[model samples]
Target chain A: MKAVLEIFQNVHMALYAIVFILSLIKYPVYKNTSLKFLPLIFLLTLVAESMGMFINKVYESPNSVIYNIYYFFYFTFFFYLFMKVINVKKYKNYIKIGIVIFWLFYLRDLFFTDIFNESFIESYIVGAGLLIYCIILYYISILQSSKVLVIKNDLLFWISVGLFLFYIGYLPIKIIRSWFYKENSFFWILLIIQFSLVIVMYLCFLTGFLWMKKKS
Target chain B: MDEKEIIIIAAIAIPISLVIIVIVLFSVFARRKNRMLQEQEEAKKVFDRELAESQIEIREETLRNISWELHDNIGQLMTLAKIQAQMAQEKPEMMTEVSETIGTGIDELRALSKLINPEALKSLSLKEAVSLEIERFNRLKFIEAKLTINGSVMPIEANTQIILFRILQEFFSNTIKHSKASTLKVVLNYSEEELSITAEDNGVGFDKSDDFLGIGLKNMKTRAQLINSTLRIDSEEGKGTALTLKYKFV
Candidate 1:
């Protein structure tokens, strides 16, 4: 069980690298201006996850600091991508305001609340923000677009669904992590669920990258 | 299981279920939206095809009118001028009548030239086009036609004007061929947001149940719908026929 769980964790990192490589291959073919940063996002995720793993496993060090740094990078790239895809001029101001508020809370948590450890509150805040963004993306994809005749093949639609499912699936685990830590059986079960959700999310990304057509 | 474990299990189950539900809902919603958009595109394509067909029909109808006018009106006028010219050579006092006949033929040729030019047909406004039709009717002595403009004239889309003119042309053709109408009146009312046109003929109109209003009326209604306009036709036995069209500017 331990060996399988370790393989699952490593596979998640490998999936990120695969996604990055796929984006690189697709970069020259798909000429969407909004998708220029796709490979960059996957590259950042791969580096962040590998570094976090190295610091925890090989160096025997706390990796919360790496995660703290990575969370900022992840949110920034995703926020920009969503803003570009949503393409609503009026909502840009609201997104800017949301980013400001999220950073203020994140910085406060980094300095004061859990300076040396992981801050579940900060993770929860970012998760909630991303969940709302995904919902808004879905709303715009459905209501604002009449030209897209095949929504199933739409890249943004799949990305939004992946984000929505992952956040919703992981949010409960994040909230109840402390309780699960003291219960061995519950911890394993929740771990399995969390890993499964991550796998599904990465699969959704792969599907989106593979199925998306070149913008005309 | 303890209470915390059960609560955790329920919490996990609820969100997973919610995720599944949302994904399914999005798929259904997207399919519905896509189908609606496709239907709209199909409708627009049909409208475009119909509009193109109507334009061709208008051109053909104009050509047919030109052919008849050349053979009947202009041909007869030229023959009369030739006869008068020959007479003037024999009798000097007949020169004035010969010159008058030639001048009248020149005027008829000028009017026919305007109708023959495709650019002129496309460039003319609804009012100008209707005026030309009325002038043709009066010159041919087919009917007494009058056109009245009620309000300030507003520029309309050229394609829309052509379609409307063609519809009125069809009505005039039917009135002259079947109605035995002596008088025809057309009114154009241009309001701030809407343009209204009414054409009424004092002739022997058929009953509402008559099959005479078949393809012609359907074509007119379809053309009006293509321009987002409304058309109404009223007729009764022995009463005159009236056609009203109201179009709103977006």
Candidate 2:
């Protein structure tokens, strides 16, 4: 059972790498749009994951610091990109406010939390909530635009879906993880679910790379 | 709650929420996609209906033209020939006059038949169709009309041709019946990317804000939009009316 779980985890990690490669392959297609630098983010994520893995498993050191920095850049770029893509003036302003709110959370982590040793849970939760709001705004903008009819071919639409699904599903698990980590069976189950979420998220990214096209 | 029970609830609840989220996302997009497709289907139906109506109107107008020609033009020629034949029975010199009149009538009949033939009409390109209309205007002395082709002719989509033909037909009809224009000009400039058409008439134009031509012009604009193009109309009182349409090659 442990071996099967390990395999699932490895497969999920491999999926991220495959999705990263696909992003590189398809980078030129979306290089002109706001996603011009999207491939770099995937590359950043892959590196972050690999480094975190090495630190935690090989060096037996905490990986939270790597992820803390990774999350900051990832969420910041997405917030900025989503703001660019959103069409409404009011919602764009709201996203600006959200960015300020996200900044406050980052400031809190920098000032109060032990970012090098522990997960930035407070800011992660706050940022994830803001990210969800940003995704909602993105959805609203998609509805307003003619892109609604042809979102299947939209690369950013798929990525947004992947992020929205992962954050939303992982929200409860992140909250409940510390309370239940002492229970081995529960931790294993959480690990499996988390691995599945990663696979699902990367699968969406792969689909976007394969099928994505500019608005016709 | 005890720790063990809370763990149990959290484990069960996490998967359930994920499943619910997936279901909601699935249903939302599916519903949106279905609605979009339905709108497309509806637009297609409306276009088909408009196309059918325009075709019927064109046929009716053609039949009206034929009736007028047969009664006023061809029928008169035949009567003149008959009168000349009776006089030729008296003088034999009138025989040539009767033959000439009969020949003119026969030529007119042939032209009308070509106009009436569905196959000929179906095979007519937009350029040819507009040229024929221009020729008819000049032949009937309705107005001094000319059609100029600038670039090499290109094949337009069949449905697009029909819709464009109807728009121009409406313009020509208005010029003849309402514009009281002395000169009507149509220019078709075809390029690799698009076909730019401008049809103008030097006539008593209307107010820019006039709703008198609103319904007709609105209908024309709607049809243009249906074909993913816009019909730009420029007119002024004591000036002329010019309609410009730029249709991209599909």
Candidate 3:
């Protein structure tokens, strides 16, 4: 079981690296599309993840600040995409408010609250919830659009599916870690589950970059 | 309340929730696929309906044009030939002119007979179809109609051609019947990825409100949609009216 857990842990970041490399190779396919900057975000995540590991190991300090900033940008990128893709006026307004709320929370969590000591769990939770809501709204918009006919070939749909699945699976894990990590006895199992979700999420991203050549 | 109890609860609950999420996602995917199939079926039906209607409309318009030519132009030629033949009884040179008039009337009647054949009309390509309409307009002196085609003519699907021709036909009818313009212009530009058709008439254009959307114009809009093309109709009161349809080849 420990060996299995170790394998999951080691595979998580490697999967992200594979997706990052694939996103580069497929850059021209989506260069003129709304997903043009999506590869850049993947590059940013891989760099941040490496930097986080380096800081935690070399400095013997918490690496929460790096991830806090990374999550902030991640949430912002998805919100920007949702704003562009989603058409419903009511949902658009909700996404705008989500952006504002995420920004305000990140500012408060970073400057006013603990920054380097612990990860920004509360703000991250808020960001995740809003992103999930935005994705659902985007799905609803796609249902009403002619785009649904070509959903399989659509890059945005694949990316949204990846985001939706990973976030929904990881949200509970995050809650348990933040609220009950100190007292939790099944922490290893949850960590392994979290790592598995990361691997699946990266695989989803790789699938999108590899096969999504149809213009969205 | 104990740490061990909380851990046990979470382990069981998390996987259960994940299973539910997976089921829900599967259902959503299934529903989206069904909706997409329905949409494709709906589009196909609309295209077939529009094609049949446009074919009928073209036949009716051809009959109208043939009737007008037979009564007004060809009929006038026959009457003139009869008077010229009577005059020829007195002058030998007038006989040659009377024969020439009779020959022209025979050619006009032959052209009308070809139009009366459904097979000949069905075989016309999109360009040929539009050319025939322009020729009829100029021959009838309805307006000084001009068709300017730029770039090599790319082959469009027959179904798509029907919709495109009908849209331009609607625009031409409106120009001749209501515009009171002396001239009408049409351009078919074939680009690398798309075919653009533009028509304009210098006339008393109508207001840009929904009130100006007649059934003919609305039908044109829907037909363009059926073919996955864009139809834009722009007009300024008293200035002129212009229509542009862009159809990208798949």
Clashes of 3: 0
Question: Global CA lDDT of candidate 1, please?
Answer: 0.78
lDDT of 2 by residue, B1-96 (tens): 876676667678777887897788768877877887888899999899878877887888888888987888899999999999999999998899
Docking class of 1: incorrect
Candidate 1 lDDT, B1-250, residue by residue in tens: 8846665775669466867768786677767787788888998888778768878887887888889898899899999989998988999899899889889888989989977798877788989989988988998888999999998999888777878888888888889888888999999999999999999999999887877768998998898998899999898767789999999987
Every model's Cα RMSD, please?
8.9, 4.8, 5.3
Scored on chain A only, each candidate's TM-score is: 0.87, 0.95, 0.92
Error of 3 at B54 (Å): 1.6
Show model 2 residue runs off by greater than 4 Å: A1-11, A18-43, A76-127, A141-158, A172-196, A203-216, B1-14, B76-106, B148-154, B189-197, B204-222, B232-250
lDDT order of candidates, best first?
2, 3, 1
> In model 2 chain A, where is the ten-residue run with the lowest total lDDT?
A178-187
Query: For model 3, what TM-score does chain A reach?
Result: 0.92
CAPRI band for model 2: acceptable
